[model samples]
Target: MHYTFSQYYIYVIFVAVMAAFSYLNKLNRTEVFSFFMYAIMLLFAVLRIDTGADYSTYIEMHEEAGKSYFTDLFSFTEPLYFLLLKVLYFFSDDYWLMFAVVAIIIYTILFLAVKKLSIDPALSLLLYIIVAYYFISINQLRQSISLVIFLYSISSIIDKKPGKYYLLNIIGFGFHYSAVMAFLIYPIVNTSFSKKTLTIIFILSIVLSPVIEKLFVTYLGELDTLYTKYFDIEEYMEKNYLALGKVIVPNLILIYSLIKFKSFTRYEYSIFMIYFCSIVYYNIFFGKHIFIRPGMYFEIVTILYIPIFIKKFFDLVTGFIIETLIILYYAFSVTLYGILINGGQGVVPYKLIFSR
Candidate 1:
């Protein structure tokens, strides 16, 4: 497939526009532009073709949906996910239409989630693009949807509603089994772990990564195909893996951010703790491709969290400098060259459905 890095400039331009509106401090225009920016992201997802490696995966799944989309719940496909396929089946056989509808749902939830949780929604959006969190929707449709559903349920986590939180995440798990990893969110966020315990876990995770992988396979590998098929360390070693840039490094910075900024509110602290679990996961599974995928469910929180970190932790001028530094890092390090070098998907050579 032809690949080009030029499509990333679109995101760069979006960030530029977002920064301009943010600095302008015009509530009405900023709100309108924020909505517009999200719409553009949704439209990008809707219009793309073969933008990611997995784009064809969903297309093939949709193509086969007529034969087996409704085979059984949890046996083959998740209920809500299968329903989406079936609904789109009636409208047209083309997967692109289903993709478009999914785009609307995914981006709508994401926009709403960021808008509500983020102190600066536009900055969150900018960070979303910078962090390449949007790749989930463009690439992994089912899990991305599942992830957003669980993200929407963050209120339950903040409100101390374990029953409600797990229920939503269980529903999310139906769509993508990986979301079951989120069950840990309830305990991690709800319970108060000391800095000592947190530090110990983080250190052990890095030092014990390979050991943990072995134990994971030894204990749970046979429990389900999830472990045997996906988490098999042997298979992972053989396949050509793609790097999404030193995934652990950015996360480690979050640890520093957490330590440096101690003024977080209860709500913010809950979010921080939730993300704290993700970093631990990444630290343990950093070098592997499959193992760290689940960690992304937590890493997405960085989009909102980072923006809040900048605003709360720095004065206006310092925040601007910090923000500029981050943007530069994203431009050269994360979003642009990082993804390009890693062969990360969804934002390259910007193909559209219309092109066909």
Candidate 2:
């Protein structure tokens, strides 16, 4: 889709409104306000038309799935996702219905996750929008569904129940294969890593990145799939190359969390490790885009972490100064960085399903 500078500001204004609702009362917004906030987000996602990067592509896929037999799509697309498309298509041929259904499922799980895990639900929901996960859902529907499913699995992870966690992630994998990466979280979070060790590992991942790329190209890139084709297509690969927001900003957050390492509760530490893995993957697989998809399973959890981190860090050390700094950063990042810098992932010039 085409994006313009004016539309970017419009998208920023939309997000600014969402932020106003989120920060209106961090401790207590009435249930009616909560309902309104969620309804706005849900409607924004559900009603969009030709607004996301993959809008037309997913529309084509939806039409194709409706016309094809299950066996035809099963070879490439995940079974459950194909099934979901088939079910939605069966109800109506309208592709908008598919987007609406997926939006409902994703936001529902996200809302539940924020309620269960977030120390500040409003802040977590705000991060969901400002951090671009909400927009990411508008674009990459299948993987976004899988990502939120992984979010739901955090409770299972924290409860230390391997069976339940695996079950949830297995369901996630059925939506997107990249969810296989989530299988490692149980062990990663369960194990304790010293701050020194995490730092060493982060440094090593960056230093060894070239070698990692060579290994991926020589071995993994040989696979004959759209994902693996990135290595061979110079232009495609260049466009998909890791961005500053994906790498540096996240690593900075990881560093910020590690700064208060000694005071971490088990739950907070688990959250930190999950986010840490996201940056590690970003660094280790720096060049190619396909390998980076797995990191999102971990990166998305940072929405939950941000609010808690801000609160804990505020209580322990920096006070409102750092809190103000973080809020300002989020405000700028959501408006300027997201729309102007990242192009809002092609979600500008927002249009509803009713629009031409």
Candidate 3:
């Protein structure tokens, strides 16, 4: 059975509660409630079944992990990725345990990352929901773990610990090869971009998206036979604009926030650059189908940035007008992603194995 609207509303209420707690906890200077909210999110993640685009695929992977020995596993995957799976599988082959392990790692990294980076943690979690980072985590298994490592390693990069930053991302790469992209944040964090440059780049990306899309597919397809099949430029071109429009308002708003809030700390700049690259590839490029998947790496930073963005942007003046826009903005984006986009395809109609 599909997750009904009632099930969808449950997630909406959950986001609202976490948002409220984040705001309150920030004011109160205690993270007790925020921690509880983190637990709730984790529980939801671990308990759910038959969710995510890769839910069944991961189950098959887990069974493989259960059967494969050390050497055989290494032939296909990074050592650590299979190692962890093997270690876990030694205990049981249940997919729930595998999901539990990944859920813990993701929520833990996100919880810690927000605590370190955001002025308001609850708001960050709220933005996480609205911006669909949490959904991405639920969908992308290996990359989710990779992203956790990337998020955790941001501080090391910001603090000028290049050795540690690179090392962490190297570890992340073991989970997903795409994680090597995290290495770029080190340089992007240090470089400066004027607002004019950012604006020009954004416009150029929009104009050249179709060209960029074709170029990327051709280049990557030359390197990998898989790319030709997975990154089909023609198939994506038709549907790309529709997906782009769904989140355009929020993307533009985020860009505005990044621009307005710029005096660029090493961390903020890193977040902005990641978000910028993703926008160029995912939104501006015509074949967002494939790009948006990877583009989410940068986009996830919006979760960390949004709380600070809202606090600073809206603090000077607060009113029904401001509050309504902000609230509606997030609620609409959540619907656009979770329902209108795909009937909450990946995460809605939450299910448990026992329930089934």
Off by over 4 Å in 1: 1-30, 69-74, 207-252, 261-263
Output the better candidate (1/3) by lDDT: 1
lDDT of 2 by residue, 163-237 (tens): 999998998988889899888889999998888998899888888987876777788775534554454334433
lDDT score, candidate 1, position 258: 50
lDDT of each: 0.70, 0.75, 0.68
* Collision count of model 1: 0
lDDT-based ranking: 2, 1, 3
Candidate 3 is scored at a TM of 0.83
Please write out the lDDT profile of model 1 over residues 1-356, one tens digit for every residue. 22344655664565566556555543463577678778878877787876777777788877766456455534664777776787688778977788888889888988888777777777777667766667556778888888888778887888888899889888888788888778877777877766777778777877797897777567755554553345344443333132333353466566676577565677888888777777777767654445655787787787767676777778878888877777667645665554544455544655778787
- Model 1 is weakest, by summed lDDT over 10 consecutive residues, at 237-246
Give the alpha carbon lDDT tens digit for every residue of 225-329 in model 3.
444335354544333323433356556765676567557666666666666766665655444344544555566776666554555566635632454466556
Flag the better candidate by TM-score, 1 or 2. Answer: 2
